[model samples]
Target: MSKSIHKPGFVLGDALDIPTFKVLKQDGTLYKGAQEPEFDKEMALKLYDDLVFIRVLDERMVGAQRQGRIPFYLASLGEEAASVGSAGALKPQDMIFAQYREQGALRHRGFTVDQFMDQCFSNDRDLGKGRQMPIHYGSKALNYNTISSPLGTQIPQAAGYAYGQKLDGLDACTICYFGEGAASEGDFHAGLNMAAVLKCPTIFLCRNNGYAISTPSAEQFSGDGVASRGIGYGIATLRVDGNDLLAVYAATAAARAYALEHNAPVLIEAMSYRLGAHSTSDDPTGYRSKDEEAQWAKKDPILRYKHWLTQKDWWSDEQEKTLYAEHRANILAAMKAAEKRPVPTIDHLITDVYDEPTPHLRQQLKQLKAHMRKYPEQYPKTSGRLDA
Candidate 1:
């Protein structure tokens, strides 16, 4: 007898029309029947403060980059709610693996303005020992993993880390932040599948800002979005208006609860648009029209949240003005201090990699120092300070 089998049919249709979860409207009013997150006044104020600080920091750093203070910079820009709002929903003990844009999350978790400046300037006080590029932030104490420049690499790493958390019986989960563009990589599939199969508690947060550098989302994928991909992998998923802070907080809080209770992974697709260039190196005007940007600017996340706070009697216009002035001065002072600090010593190049430097490594360092001496004038003032 011939071995015959019938293949099941799958239909390609809009069966899963994922709705965007939104609490706060563009006019800053809560939608009827939409419940607010369980956040107190103190937490609400802090979240709003983070949103403002990140915005001001981005504006200042971009100017700094143009002035040749920093080599490269990527701003969170219009996606502050997607970073700080979601971060605020989680406990500090939970691990965060970020794409370079989630600096607001770091700030929300106690990464100070001075610490940010130190890292950006690559000074001696920088946690990365001046090895990584500016904005590649990391903090073990805050449970935020060091950001790697390679895209989508953290997806698999987050799955593995969350699996270890599951085995260790820890009460925390891992949250991985990435762009919709990174979802195009194979690591995304591998990581989500691993988390699904292993039942790891990981929250995959995709900031779908409509562009992966210069490529638009339409050119990147034909699917509904990142949330649909999560459903395909048998993971719980959500799509939210990334500009609405309350919506992000509510969705993330619920997602975290489900992940921890069920020991499963979740995906959150934040639908927001980047209000600035992708980076200092990118000119978004070349690909996106100014009219399109102007349209999104009308839905500014910070303004929307500020309006909400004012409506709740938690903030006022005078307070906003005072806060902005104070933040600008503080940031300016921090940057100046960071610029004056020396860079890490040359010995830091090989110290963190291993417990002890091998013969070959020591030889390489010696060679590097001799080369630096030969080209002393070419090196920066900080680079010449071997004892730094």
Candidate 2:
């Protein structure tokens, strides 16, 4: 009889698996053997500020969606540590392919409040030219790919891009963020296999948010957790406490080193939960209990991290109050202004693809314009940026 050999310390299906490292507890006490981040007081304060800003942004945008100010929104409520911590460990030149919920990464990378509002409002100044639905963000300078609605497509794209980085022999790696729910898709399998075979320098970050829409993680798979899938693909992998920012930062920092040095993909499974609905369109209450939601809320990323900072004598209640107020005011002011701004220029509809608009494209634009003019009252407001 052949006995199955499992790696030492690699526990499958546990909320904590693989590296499963944690630096701080919920009360902000350090677990023995964990090292604190090498952050000065100024930088630490800025990091806390970013968390506050991201929370406010998510909160306001969700309200916008509910009030019909925007068409849709996806809040990254409880998963901020995974998003922000992973992005924090990377150089800005590294690429990111986010699955729509990692806006905290963008916030940490210095994306302007104006820029966010522009996309949400579909304003003329929006970089995407109002083409994407709200929250679909990208910037060439930032090296972030524009968001896509299809699940798991970015997983393979990330592997392919990382393969290019490997061939180019660049120091930069690619980070692709997706939910554990996304790991269930076929593309997730294909991406991992390609990355393993090609030895691409990629960090596949799976935020196991305990739900695929409203369905619980218990309903998603039979195996322990998403971490098992990474080892199955033969890639180096780590699992971390997603609510513990320090743990996430430390793990991702190590993961980056392993990926960059080897030019081989690494998978990180961050155990966390979504404290909000899947989207503005979803209702989690039907499938999840209030007690469950309350339990996850108690493990809030911002709070836990704040407590850690305080434990180190780096933060205070006064500072937290000040940061929250600033973020709230800034979000409200920017959003109101954005909502009143005009939509993207009509000429943009036929530009950007070629030196000159093609005959077929021009024909389509003309037809669209005619339809708009025909129902001037119906199409009164300039149609918010056309989807390319």
Candidate 3:
């Protein structure tokens, strides 16, 4: 079926212009022909609540980090809709593998304010047992995998998990979340190819938020974007306006349905911007301009969604103020309680590794405790229960 061209010819990669799917415009009205998402009052309100919660959580946590209360933090900031909307479309049974910034999705999936505080403070109540840095969240009960610090580790893991779901004949799929930067990693290629060839039901959601911690997308790749690569991998793909909540929800819902029905992988490239620094440590002023930030500010997804809700009479200005005030109080209370709690004891470090601790491991723990005891002045007494 080849064209059988004898002359030497090369095709431009940009020839295929992918259009971004949009439902809600900047002014909070749907495009003339855009079909509204199937969102009920409860669903719409829940998404809005999660968005506000995430925003406030980011602001407070970043402030906490700056005050030296917490070691570090990452904020979804301008990109809240990407995670919240796609997550809203999935069934609770589906597994989620996120790359740090999808706290909105976790919150939407029932993670409480206290739980978030516990993890950030690395208190005894933290699910990760103080092993991971702040913002790396997970919950077994929620089917959310523990986030690993290394980039792209979860992509292939998601593919493998989706294959397992297929073998078990479970009516569920795995949704993997990562930034465009992670797409440059070999794992992204391996994961997508594995899912495609294995016919695993998986959704690879890429938050194309313009930058990978300061590296702009222009330098990250020369192609059309992440979605264009999905086509190269022979996977179904879609590009969506990440700032449009309804557009994200519709695209993800459709992608989920397609992947499950065909037992194939689908990739979604969400075009958005990272309005905050890569982390509390980095200063965005060094790499980006304020004017650019201001331009994106006009397209704030939460504000857009709020406008739509106001139009529907589902939300009001007073409700916005109340939600922010309530969440601020709740988050502050939770943070105080979590920080007051002691960290997990030293024995906790080795307990979960095996059924019974090995002699060498126990020896290491013993040596660690002795080191702490001998240098009590050097180590924080609240680091763990060294007396044990």
Candidate 4:
């Protein structure tokens, strides 16, 4: 039973007709009737290597957190293709605003092992002066905004930054990364609406990883996942297989092109899963069964990429072994060196915030020093920093 219908203001068909974008399948095969996006051998190798590096980073850091070596950690795990692929699509000068778990993006932008470890260890040399938690990576050269802990705060900020970029008349755009968990926040709606109305050049990349902490996606939203919501807000939206790195890269590259040409916003929903616990503080086994976890393990992005790379003669098992060992050794050595580095000096705390420490600010610093001195044994590592 079909009937003619129309809304005066609406032009597109119903939401269900809107396509979900994808390029690869779980068996390391292409879609039956779809053509794969073309990429040269060198570029494909670069993407594959970045995925391997990030997977190693996530694996080792989770172990470090378990051993009480770091305060906290988040795993990108199954979502590597989404972050790395999207970041790979952006120009070096483009800005990146990320929620936690987008470490892959930082690594892709050439953030070093020492830089990552310095942030984790709160070392004096850390760019943020160790103010942020581990995995909250940002780099000035990379133009990646420092990650904020509050959920969805970056969403609206991304829109405003994109607007500013447009005013500057630059071809650059802003890409903000968030999880499905962050999509639940009020700021997500506000950010999308603002970007739409203002026609800001922002790309909202949502890593819909199927869980918000222990809560499953089925329990989180009754509507069709995050994609439908982006369409509702009148933004051009696409959903790609998050594990399919090629698809994500293709989609993001196209989105980047559109945003640059039109100064408009685009929403990308990358459908992936959390291959590890939510964080060091979480226990997924408590809420979800191990069998479910086992299923996702088979779809690991690293393995999928390795299959395709080997199929294309771009990689070998021996090369994979060498690469993993190299990154693992580098990360361990860097972490040890970074941990032993001294904490940020007392003056660094206030220098970046104000022209000079005011009378009241100076007094507060004095009080902080006094407290540290009063409890030297317990605050030994603090070294007069208030945050410690």
The C-alpha lDDT values of all candidates are 0.94, 0.87, 0.94, 0.87
Report how far off residue 323 is in candidate 4 (Å).
Answer: 0.5
Error of 1 at 143 (Å): 0.5
Single out the weakest 10-residue window by summed lDDT for candidate 1. Answer: 379-388
- Model 4 lDDT, residue 323, Cα: 94
Q: Which stretches of candidate 3 lie over 4 Å from their true place?
A: none
Better of 1 and 2 by TM-score: 1
lDDT of 3 by residue, 318-337 (tens): 98999999999999999999
- Give lDDT tens digits, candidate 4, residues 100-176: 98888888899988888899888898999877788777788889999988899999999999999999999899999
Candidate 1, which segments miss by more than 4 Å at Cα?
1-10, 382-384
lDDT of 4 at 314: 81
Q: How far is candidate 3 from the true structure (C-alpha RMSD, Å)?
A: 1.2
Per-residue CA lDDT of model 2 for 1-388, tens digit only, reads 8568777655445553445778888888889887887767786776778788888999999998889999998899988898988888888879999999988888888899999999988888899987889889988778898889889999999999999988888989999999988999999999999999999999999999999997788899988688888888899988889988888888888888999998899999899999988999999889989998998899998999898888889888887888888889999999999999888877687787899999999999888877876676786567643332
- What TM-score does model 2 achieve against the real structure? 0.93
Instruction: Please rank every candidate by TM-score, starting with the best.
Output: 3, 1, 4, 2
